[model samples]
Target: MQQEKMNRSLTLIPVVLFGFSFMALATVFSTYGVAAEISHGMVSGSYLLALIVMLFTAYSYGQMAKAVPSAGSAYAYTQKSISPYVGFMVGWAVLMDYLFIPMVNYLLFGIFFSAAFPAVPSYVWILGMLLLVTIVNVKGIKLATVANAFISLFSLLFILIFIGLSAKDILGGAGTGTIFNLEPFYNPEESFSYVVAGAALLCFSFLGFDSATAFAEETINPKKTIPRAVIIITLVGGAIFMTVSYFAHNVWPDYTTFTNADAASHEIITSVGGKTLASMFLAVYFVTVFGSAMSSQASASRVLFAMGRDGQLPKFFGKLHHKYQTPINNILLISVVSLLSLFLSLTLVASFINFGAFIAFISVNIAVIAYYFIRKKERSFKGTILYLILPSIGAILDLWLLLNLDIHSKVLGSIWFALGLIYLFFLTKGFKQRPPELHLGAAESS
Candidate 1:
């Protein structure tokens, strides 16, 4: 019997929108206060620094996408460029990223949705979102892309409104009275370590760009389109983050004034646009979270499908729906996992997701070095910088972030990695041979 494959239907616009939605532009509202306090009011600076660091990693991903345009993403790149053992491990690590991100997003959506509509139970909202997204994803990628684009437009609209209101408040002398203030970007009281710590936390907000690679199998002209979408989403999303955070910092320059640091953005919105607009903002924010859950779940299923196809996971995961050309089983698995959000705390979910993301980032950067330098022996100066120097910096920064993760995250992540090793031991039969590989036709459009 022949295996089913995803239809190559996604174009650059939908792919970029999907990436942006996965990043969830409204994250600034949820994280702004903590970021501000950690950076000592230098939220913009921290985001800028994080963006610069992520760009190196993004460049490496672009190169790898060009080389291996498949849905496997980091797993495929690491496996083909390095060792299959390492690839399986990378895939295992990313399970945390792809798997739990949807859970986290859904959890947030439940919390916010319930807060907006107190009569409905949060669990109902969570389960409803999970079911809706699972159905859309199982139907096909094109529908998911269309759904994401619609949600992304609403998110962008809210962001623009917030920015406009913030500028009006500043220029009208209600806040800082000037947009040229450097206080949001630099603070004499902020230590370098503080900014670095904030950057580590902010890394969570920038994770979705690489997720574009997970759709390579379904994306039209993926070799060219995926790389461009990855870079575009990262840069565009980073700019939006920094710009919004800057205005927000200017409006609420004193972190001590916030009643609750985590809720500071809400307070700022109320201050700038009144309670009515704040309510509206919260409603829109919920929409962004819903979109994020959809996008994250879709990406997660694709990664699992890639692994299943390659035999790194059970063959059931590799099976696609004959009619829709979608990975129905993997989509169902993610939906089941997302139900755990009702029982788990958001902080725990966020920590483990970050743990997985940083590990995968580190692995991908190393894959670039191995594939281009050690394996292929590419020696041109441009190649040297692209494959060696940038990736080295990316690896170092990712390691720094990994090491600096909170103790709970480190502990949980360590336990997860240990479990992955045990599974690998059995999967590879005591490391006697390379893991099985699945050939899913030629690489997409390379």
Candidate 2:
């Protein structure tokens, strides 16, 4: 078999630009903000805090991505740094994260599409969008990458315009008192514990930063480029999201209004401006969500394909097109799963998928801790505290959120995770034999 290598057409643009559009950004910030509005406010402040946390959290991944440059992201890093079992679990965790997230993105699109044009059933649009994206992804990576870039670029332009128009409206005295109220943080009425739990909801929204690591095999000068992409995408995407949150809060002001509009056209966007501006914003929303859905599908399929090639999944899943060098079978599988997910209730699909993400976040954090200790790479107590202790706390916090998920989502998420565990056991039993390693250095010297 040929060695695993990626075609290096991907640049920082695909890594950064594509996933930052309004549909994705809006869904993330608005969802978190809406939840916070019901539970509390200062979601804008919390978003800023998340950015800060991500900056520090991202540094370790940046270093590791350069050092390893593998396809499966945390799954690859944790395995090399620890053991294959750890790798297997990490892969299982992320497979859910990658799989469900696209479904969430597409479901959100279905919601908005149904709202924008009330004649069509939301589920139809959801399934249709999922099908179209799946077809696009199955064609090839190069095509998907190029499409992501163009769609993201257009989406970015519309978002900027939306923000500008919203800012002007706020300045013109059409804004509400909640726009200036930072009272949510100090308010006696808010539940602090739920707010902490609510932070988990925001966790998945900031996920695209890892796209760099996922695309590592495809990048030229991966060591230099991958780290740069990881850091830049995190900071830049964080900045844009923070700014979008700021504008969204300023325009809608009372976060509760968004939640009240739940499963409907978010009044937050409609409340922003004139029909011309609204039309422009709606157009922006279209591409923004479409890009996020597409990006998620593309990234998730690659992870599945890698695992399959390692004999940890169905053998047919490992097949790639000879000419395109793309994982055709894997992409098709992802597309089918995504379409199935979309046809179900959006809320139902989101419930099942959300915990996969929480578990992933928890698993990766713990893996970083385990890797450090197992390797004894650094012996200092302080280093241990910094890497292991903090991430453990993070993992614990994530698990708490997972546990607290509403009964419906929690039950579904558990079933899905259980299926993954069963699949993992079969793979482990089937491929118990170890493979030999090659040393290019020794061969060259000899």
Candidate 3:
């Protein structure tokens, strides 16, 4: 029998919706407090800077997808454009992100729910979310697609409501007494470095937009559609983040006053909409958290499955459930790791995830230059700008952001990368041969 292939019926609209669902519009509020404090009330500036970094990387992904529309995403881009060895390392780095995102969502869910119902412990809420997401992944996450679409729509409505209420409060002389204030974007007393630092953390909020490239095999006219979708998603997500954050800062300019930075969005919501609206916000938040947790858990398991099948780990991780046709072992393993969130903080987890993301982003940016500028020799002025100058700047900015990450993220990320290096050393027998190429079709689930 012929091997099955992904269906090629997804058009631009569906593909764009997939990107939106992956990168949830509601995430802006999730990190609002931390970013506001870190940026010195300049959360909007941080998001704007992060958007510039992502746009450059987005262009590279688009170009690579146009040239090599494969299911591997960043892994495939580096493998075919650069080399298999570089590809393996990049894949490993991205795996760090897929591994931790579920935990981030779990922790966020716990933070919000526990605050609403102080009678219940946070861990209980976290445990419940993890158990639900694990079961959904163990069976299949196709149902998650429909659920995510609904959540995505509701999240937009949620954001719009917040924006309107925030504007109303501003009119009533709250915050800076104006809807648009330059002070929130750049406070004179604080160093501009604060904005850059906040941008590093805020990158996590923009994580899902590039996922459009993963659907190349399934999208109609992928060379065109996928590239457009990726660019549009990046811009749209960035705009939402910047706008929402701008309004958030104006509604509450005193970030330092937040009782708990991690759960600050809750306070802002209640203040803006009062008790009844705040209660409604809590319900919608639960669904948003549920959708994000389930999808993230599913993606993490798929990456583990891909690595196991390639012999990077024990084959047990590669094996699917006999009846469910899913990676049961990997799902369970990730669930166990997610339990760590109960002991961790939000900024730390967000930084940990970005450590790998920046590496992957830098690698993809370099991969573009290596593929087009050197191998293909596109030496014309336009080609030089697109393939050389632009990508180099992207790499530099990504490196800067990587360095800006808190010391803990760098330490942990270094340890994670070091482990990958040791594994590669043995797998390649001391770099005498090429590393094994990963089968990334299933791993690109998100």
Candidate 4:
């Protein structure tokens, strides 16, 4: 079999960065990030506090991405600053982080598509979206990038419209006369710790800033553009999320509006006006989920391809199509796994993919801390704590959440590990059989 390397032809300005943030918002928007800010009276001030934390961490990431634009993302960043073992774990943790995001978006797609087209089965929509993204990605990176750009544009417009419509309702006195009050902050029912936990959940929505870093090899002027993209996408995406979340609930200050166990998430935006606005919002929601899934599929495929080519995975997983110039095997694996995972979810057997994602986040954060600590910059203890300490604490909190995840999730995640380990074992053996001279090519290309 002939080797087919990835094309560095995908030179674009900060798209994957924007797409990452857009996808992240879509992933967590309907959940607590937007929901909490809207219904729980946590918008603006409290949400902004969460944003501050994200901004600091994102700045650190931006600096790192600029310094070393590579495929491994946190793994590469940490390795350069720390050790290869830390890099290995960061890579391991990212398997789920990158893989399950599409799963979350897939679930969101099923829900909103059901709302939009009541007659059709939700799983049908799920399957259709999966097939469509797979085909688009199977074409090549340039095509996938174009698709992502269009979807991201449409999705952004949709979010802005929802925010505008929600604002109209707020100003029109449609809200239940809750006097724009600051009383919620002092209410005994709410505590800072709960708020922090809520922020952690919300933080998930803002967690994809570094996603752009993974596409470093594909970007134009990456050393500069990639980092700028990270910051820009984070701020832009964060602004949209904060604005929507604040007003989504501001239009109806009562938490009861959305907290009901049977509440349709689509109702939050639709109830603001008439069926037209509601329908539009739902349409955007559908595309948002679709776009998120597509971007994630592309990212995941690249990671798998890179790993496979490096002799850290099965060689077949690394193969790029001779003509298409795409990672055909990697893309197929991602699409199949995602669809299978979706199938499991429909059967009520799918585990909590979010647990895997958060675990990856904690791993990345911890990796960053270790990297900074081992650097020979000779910085003071105070500087070290400011950058590294808080992030480590954040990782601990993330671990606590992962520990608290459902049994099915833990079980499935362990299964995922067993599979990875089996593959790793074969990968290790295969490397031992390769001629020493052949190994040099992988190193030089990498």
RMSD of each: 1.5, 4.1, 3.8, 4.4
Which lDDT values do the candidates have, in the order given? 0.86, 0.64, 0.79, 0.62
Provide the lDDT at 360 for model 3: 85
**TM-score of each predicted structure versus truth:** 0.97, 0.84, 0.87, 0.81
Displacement of residue 40 (Cα, Å) in model 2 is: 3.2
Compared with the true structure, model 2 gives a TM-score of 0.84
Candidate 2 ranges beyond 4 A from true positions:
18-23, 28-33, 53-57, 121-124, 176-198, 255-259, 263-266, 380-397, 430-446
Listed per model in order, the count of residue pairs whose N, CA or C atoms clash below 3 Å is 0, 0, 0, 1
lDDT of 3 at 334: 91
Ranking of models by lDDT: 1, 3, 2, 4
Q: For candidate 2, what is the lDDT? A: 0.64
Which is the winner by TM-score between candidate 3 and candidate 4?
Answer: 3
Residue by residue across 5-96, what tens digits does model 2's lDDT show? 45777666665554453125545434644545544655555555556555554655665565566667777766666667666666777777
Worst 10 residues of 1 by lDDT: 437-446
**Candidate 1 lDDT, 324-347, residue by residue in tens:** 988889889889888899999998
Top candidate by TM-score: 1
Q: Where is the poorest 10-residue window by lDDT in model 4?
A: 435-444
Clashing pairs in 4: 38-249
**CA lDDT, candidate 3, residue 262:** 79
User: How many clashing pairs in candidate 4?
Assistant: 1
